[model samples]
Every structure is written in C-alpha cells, then in structure tokens.
Target: MAAIATDTHPYGRVSRLFHWGMAALFAWQFVTVGARVLLPDGALDDFLWPTHKPLGALLMLLVVLRLVWALVDRTRRPPSLNLAAHLGHLALYALMVAVPLVALMRQYGSGRAFSPFGIPLMSGFEGEIEWMTAIGGIFHGLLGWVLLALVVGHVGMAILHRRLSDENVLARMAPHAGQSR
Candidate 1:
C-alpha cells in the first residue's frame, strides 16, 4: 500500500517499525539499568544486569540498521518540526552510536570474550588495555544517564509541541494520523 512507504503523509511502515521497535528496546534497556542501580546485589539486579549487555548489543545493531534506513528514506521522510528538533535527533543518533561503541571497546579492553546472543563478537586476549577500559568506565554510565535525560526531554517536547502549539508532532509518526508537512 502507498501508506506503507511514505512519510510525506504518515510515516512509512518501515520507519514506524524502526522507531517504535527501538523505543521498546530502549525502554527495556533503561529498565535493566534502573534495576541494577536501585536494587544492586539483590535478586532483581541479578536478573536484569545480565540482560543489559546482550540487549545493548542487539540495540547497537538495530540502531545501525535504522540509521541506514533513515539515510535511504531521507527524501521520503517528513521534515523535522524545527531546527531544535533536527539537532536533538542528531544528538540522539550520536549518543546511540557512541554509547554501545565505547562499551564494546571496554569489553575488548577487558581481555574478555563477548558473545551477545551466542555469536562470538570478540575473542579474549591475554591482558587488558588500560586506556580503553578507562574511557569506557568514565563515559559509559555518564553518557547513558545523559542519553536518558535527552530521551525524556525529547518525549516532553513532543507532547509540549502538540499541546501548546497544536503541532500534531506526535501524530506524524502514528498510524493513520496527522502529518506536519
């Protein structure tokens, strides 16, 4: 159907799929982090902590695919709500890529094998690399928190734009809904 592939109207099926699917995954990722933080060394932490890395790896892969899809669909997609929205999206993309990348670098530096979803990503080494681990240690949690804040802001702005300006910002991506463009 035409609606399945054109964001100039409503967002295309593929784009919506990527957006909402990633949103759910990101939500789960944050839940895992929250559990780890709030219930440290407890049963909840034990259960959620293990899912974090594997889910993060999965998210990394999906983000890459989504970015490529975005580029390919650039002309077909609706324009951003404003300059701030454009820049906010860019920041989201950057942090999405950077967070997992640094975590993987740290994994490599730890001289440990990483096999997310049972696929061998890295082979364990004999010794650790200090600088890589240091960078990961310093930035991973900090940037993750920052990313969370940005995500919250993003959601808030979407709602605010819709409520205060009657922009229908949220509807643009929803099924059979309004298009700002």
Candidate 2:
C-alpha cells in the first residue's frame, strides 16, 4: 500500500500536538475557573484562581501560534467534515482570541501592572479607564462560559460523528501510533 499524504490522511504530528496540547491546557483553565466559581475564597480557589490570569495569557499566546499553524497547514490538515464543523471551529477561535484580549484590555485599563511570568507586559498607572474595564467585566467571564459550552458541543459532535457516521473525527486530532489513515 502507498503511504498516505498528510493532506489526505488524519492530522499530521504537528497538528495533533497542537490540538491535544491545547486541549490539556484548556482543561486546566476550566479547572481553575470552576474552583473559583464553586469554592469562592477557599484554599483550592485561592491557589488555582491566581494561576488563571497567567495561564490565560499563555493560552492566548498558544492560540495565536496555533491559528498561524492551522493556516499554514490548511491544505495539509484533514478537511472539516461538514459546515457545522467548520463554523464550530471558527467560533472556538473567535472566543479564544476575544476572551484574553478583553481581559488584557481590562488589566491595562485598571491601572494595574500585569507581568505574566514576570515579563512586565503592562505597567501600572493612575486612575482606571471605566469603559475598558467595563467591557472586560461584562464580557470576559460571560464569553468564557460560552466558549466552554461550545467546547462541550464540539466534543459531543466529534463523538457523535464517529458513532453515527463513517468519519472518525476524533482520530484526526488524537494520537494513535501506527494507525493507518
């Protein structure tokens, strides 16, 4: 049998790495957020919640890199099986970018210095910008939850696609050694 090209096979190693790596990070992000919502000021919440901002910053960076990689690999990556799959992926990308951008705007506008991993991205200033902070306050958490919902839907659809149709959508992004395309 001829070896399958990445363009026609399941996702290449780089694409799978990006997919699963981001999935793991997102799972951690959700845990932190969940701890905050459920435990409030308790120990777990206190510890995990502090990590949220830094992790969000990291996720923002990763998502940007992933987006560029996806575009570069567009022709080589496995095609979306349907219109819903295409649109769902787009929504995920939109929310991923928006959530962090809004938070960073709020952080800057609050006149609070933010140094994720001590890089000193934003410096403190006097007085808050009401509009920017307001935008982040109103939309950040709300859209995050919306993104979570979409992620759930995305996973559900992937599983459903495998069970109901001929496509094994999950395998495209999952790691399976020595498996044929």
How far is each candidate from the true structure, as Cα RMSD in Å?
4.3, 3.4
Error of 2 at 146 (Å): 0.5
**Pairs of residues at least 3 apart in sequence or in different chains that clash in candidate 1:** none
Error of 1 at 16 (Å): 0.9
For residues 27-117, write the lDDT of model 1, one tens digit per residue: 9889999998888999988988999999899999999999999999999788886798999999999999999989998999999999998
Candidate 2 Cα misplacement greater than 4 A, ranges: 1-8, 175-181
Q: Taking the tens digit of each residue's C-alpha lDDT, what string does model 2 give over 1-181?
A: 2223322368888878878888888888999999998999999998898889998999999999999999898997777767988899999999999999999989998999999998998999999999999999999999999999999999998776656655666666763522543
Off by over 4 Å in 1: 1-8, 176-181
Q: Would you estimate the TM-scores of all the predictions? A: 0.91, 0.91
When summed lDDT is taken over every stretch of 10 residues in candidate 1, the lowest stretch is: 1-10
Error of 1 at 80 (Å): 1.0
